[model samples]
Target: MHPRLKAVSFAVATLLAGAASAQSATHIAVTDAPDAQSATADAPASTALSRVTVQGARVRELPISSGALGARTDLETPFSTRQVTAEDLDARQVKSLGKIFANDASVMSLGDTFSFNAYSINVRGIPLDDYNGYKINGLPFFMTTVELPVESFESVQLLKGSSGFMYGFGAPGGIINFVTKKPTDKTLFSADLGYRSDGVFSEHIDAGGRVGDDRRFGYRLNLTHEQGDTYNGANVQRNSGSLGLDARLTSALTWTADAIYQSRRVKGGVQDFFLDDFNGDTLPKAPSGRKNLGAAYDNTFFNSNVFFVSSGLRWQIDPNWSAKVDVSRSQDRRRYSGQWMGLLNGAGDYTVYLNKAQGAATYEQAQALVEGEFTAAGLRHQVTLGLAWQGLNKQTVPKSLYTPIGQENLYAPITPLSWNGSYDDSLQYHNYHSAQKAVFASDTVQFSEQWSALLGLRYSDYDQTSFNTAGTVTNQYHKTPVTPTVALMFRARPDTLLYASYVESLEQGSTVGQTYVNKDEVLAPLKSRQYEIGAKHEGRDWGATAALFEIDRGAEYANAQNVYVSNGQIRLRGAELNGYWNLPAGLRLTGSAAWTAGKYRETDAELVGHRLEGIPKWQGSIGASQKIPGVEGLSANAELHYYARFDADSANKYKLPGYSTVNLGVSYETQIAAHPVTLRAGVDNVFNRNYWGFLQSGYTFVGAPRTLGVNAKIEL
Candidate 1:
């Protein structure tokens, strides 16, 4: 990845202002190889010019100032930021949120079929349990109830570290903020309608407009609908949308409000069974060597409802200073009513899987943030403050509908995948809980137009009091934590920057602080800390960056009921390199590679010196798009990703082999009927190789099998 001496010399000369700028030099860098940009551009044949981003920020000729203490939303930006631009998103033809997750290295999704195409994202192999709240448009509000429509977003931004200073009480690993596309001054609108390899169809809309003279006010709306079958036949369908309005409240004081709504009725399939549940519990007993129940296994189904509202306002406050505030409210509701034949019959205690779960769960949260920034003598500074509150409600009732007999019939036999029992709707259980409130703040300071530093802190106090529908307290717990972050950056050159940062994060145990019997003692909070250092160089034609990081996470154990504190501590150390290069003659390329080592410090982790459970030791990807020099309307793209082998459990008990997959795409677009149109087609897993990103049941969910997509669009 090192540049040749000539490339570096040209770069230095440009900085020294001693060289005749290279053609397209405004958009590219001399140090980048001619074809480097192809690695990042989408549809190499794209006739439109390309824009490359280093970290999360755009590699523009002019720098835009913000009130944020550095880049608050991108972990890669500070030193290890990663970005997936709108163009790449479109060319990849991603439809679900899980697919979009590929934009980053630290993320891996369980896919669309598990929770009715719902998702469980593993960041650095750590599950997201809402310790660090998710945000929308820089607000602590969450989209509690729905799937994301790719066409509705300008892009998704991920901020790693202690961001609580701005959003309040979140996981230390980092924060992910979904930046919805804002309405622009254009009166015309656009739409995309297509179907994927799976038996699913989708339609999305994007519309916006300017409000008055000078067009200071603007509004945008995004809507999406998709319904289809998974590789497994589980039914899937979702509807989600976003509406935003930005008013130039005097140019110096603007008000922006955006709302997001989503609803899904997805049927779940029997997901992976916990290793402990299979061994110790001895319930839901499957014969040994069983990796998965198989594609032929009947699926369990569940339905859920989700919704949220987010809004923000910006005030010039004064020419030298500006202030902004944002708020978001969200609700999540789930209804699990399914019949898993052997699930409830768990050879001995199948009740765990309970072929029948007539239960309902709902959780809601609210958060707000206020920020101010200033500019003086080439120096810029930004400060942000925030608060968060969250609550959870639950209810359960035994159903006789699936049980053949009445009351006692709740134990009736279940049809592996069908609900053929009677409904009782008699026996019932319910518990309600809530999270602690947190307040936080942080300062980001930039000096001499080249150096920047950020510091932030947050305090949280949580009180959980759960009760039975009978109005009796069933559990009570409390805890509090204080977290902080510090980061420093040195701009080696206008186009290059280097930085280092340290951050702390905490997560409340969902079942940790419960007031159970002597066997169910209260659980302690989980903690994590991260350190990272790296550098970046971005320009129009080429952009690249490299970084090293280490993260330490505290204990996760099972309760005294003889539990192992499922939350053991873990440590991760590694480095990643990624970037894009676009050169003359229509050649472009971009890619990333990483080597990681992780392990557990506690727990009877059988694999003492082994990598952390289920985490990969090495993983990386590279992609390229190219124009055939003289091919006016033709372009091609190729991408390859590799994941190294690693264990699946804490004991270093089982190993999941490493695998690699490749994707290729091509397209052609031009004026047809004077109405411009674009045509695209791509195949994932091009070789149609059968592989698994991780072990599932007896069979790993097949990596998206050789898949295909064709899209066409007309701009008005």
Candidate 2:
């Protein structure tokens, strides 16, 4: 066994032993009391102990939204999905999307918190589309360089496969949906104070309740502010606010509205390293992750703002029929002025370059759906019919200014040159527009008590246009496609489900980055197909799932000429296993493992069968939480993540070494003056391991350093 694994095992064993001994001592003291008076004196302690129960068991049963298909539990859904509730977010001290999915083997980080202002990930070895892969309450939103406030959401759901039939057009990678917090039946109010490593501090407030004599009006409000220096020698400030309102117009109809606004600013942001100019045969060793190689005079920063508004209505037409209609609009704006370093040789000598640009994307969507059940041909059928329309408008400056600045050495660095450039934001023009209209339907037929089949189809008309600053059309694309999905499910037992599904999707293509030779070029849309087989088992004290999946789609990459093009087909096959167990003696365990094999086909001879870049063949995580036997509301939790080595480039010439990281945390819950309070503290990357975290588009980023976080929450 590996030395690190052995050490971790020994530590867990020691902790369990100590907890058992403590519980034994408490039992002896209580039984050997001098008199009845002594037992009465310990009544408060007993009460506190009773209040502490197992945590995280309720997460598995949370209902998940399936777009127009309606809501369903994990066991009822034919696809693999996961939900992270607000409680899980607080307990894990999550600050970014990457942190929220740290323990998920099916998701891998493309950019960490410190590497970029916005977070990105690869699901099933494919990167999600920034414009189509993210949704808020089943509506589309642009997510490039935008990070929403986590406190404003009640839960986040992840669907792990193609969703063409569910949503009109999207990437085959997956979908991430953010569910907003709504007014509650009982009055709720809470305040939180938090501190992160390097002097970052935050304060947040949340409140929700109903109003009026009839209790027909409801409202939920959230406000947050955070500002401080970051681990990478950068200063960041953020402010955000959100409100949700609902009105019960009649006995069976409800109207809901939500609005959100956030502003994020950063100074002295981290610089990404570009290896396009490197002449060495092998990559250089990574430096200390905490080292600040950027210049003080660089004056690099990013200013981002996001605004969203949505309104919807839900009507119960009858006892077994329901209808919903929703419309939403959102805008994401960002201004970036930063430096990217270009490596010159193996010695790490590099030249700094500056870039300044501003851009914004506006998205509008409307959807209507109806769901009902009926009996047809001696079989019970559940049906859903929906229509959806969505459009996007992208605007940007005519050109981004790029210039070479100064030079520096990696091992022996010198001071940076002063900033000598400026940005012009006056002339912004529309660069791209896209629209989609679709009608979709699905039927689930139950042939017997234990057998069912689902058939779904969607027909869509998609239009895309790209224009130059002069309003001249540069590119245009139009297509009409029909996507379909079919699934068969069987109930092996009362609590076990086995299913097989086939799905097809139409995915939006990629846009060439500014660094590429052919900048501002938009590729044509691609078609993708997926096949999956899985089994799920739900028990009183445990839940488990296993799945095997394969995906095939058109591949695009930067060739030797530094031009981005689509010339081949990419195929990915993988297997995943996940489970959780609520063990005896206040111990809980969770684990997941994934193995993926990827290859390129029908491409250049030299690139045939080459492995995909930035994808690990094996990844997994294990976590354990143990409650203190004699102490009430106190628990210690630890998690370990492992990633196997994989190729860093399409040529398969360089390989990144495998690495592992560990995170540890503890929390205590108690009452102060009749109010409930909880305190938590945690440290990530406990060993301070230094390694490369991501490699994409010829840019490589280093992993984050060890960091600490402490938080306190009080309920009133």
Best of the candidates, TM-score: 2
Q: What 10-residue stretch in candidate 2 is worst by lDDT?
A: 39-48
lDDT (10s digit) by residue, model 2, range 1-716? 22322334333223323322211000000110000011000000000010112554342243467875675666667887767656667777787877666667888878756444356878888888887888888789998888788888776788888888988677888898887777776677888888887778888888888899788888888898988887777777989998888888998898989899999887775657777777777667766666666553457888899999999998889988988899999999988878777778777788787877889999999999998999989999989999999999999999987778778776675576776567687689999999999999999899998999989999999999999999999999999999998888887776677777888888878888777899889888878888877777666566677777788888888787878888778888887777666678888777777889889887677778899888899998878778988999998888888999888778887667789988888889899999888888888888889877664756777677788888888888
Pairs of colliding residues, candidate 2? none
What are the models' TM-scores?
0.77, 0.91
Model 1 ranges with Cα > 4 A deviation: 1-79, 113-117, 131-133, 141-146, 161-166, 212-217, 267-270, 273-299, 337-382, 385-430, 445-452, 510-523, 557-568, 605-610, 693-702
Q: Per-residue alpha-carbon lDDT of model 1 for 1-716, expressed as tens digits?
A: 11222233234324323211221111221111001111111121111112222223353332111113423333224634334445656666765555655534556655433342235455555655543445555544333224554565555555444443444455555565565666664474666666656566777666777778788767777777777765544566677777777777684777777777766665644333333333342222222111222222244556666566766666656654545555556665555544222222234333223334444444455555566687777677677676666565555542223331111111233333333445455566665555657777777788766778878777878776666568688767677777777878777776666677677776655443111232223345567777776656665556555656677777553333535454567777765555656656566666665567777676554534556655676766666667645656677877776777666555554455667778777767666777656667777766666544343211123345566666666555
lDDT of 2: 0.75
What lDDT is obtained when candidate 1 is compared to the true structure?
Answer: 0.52
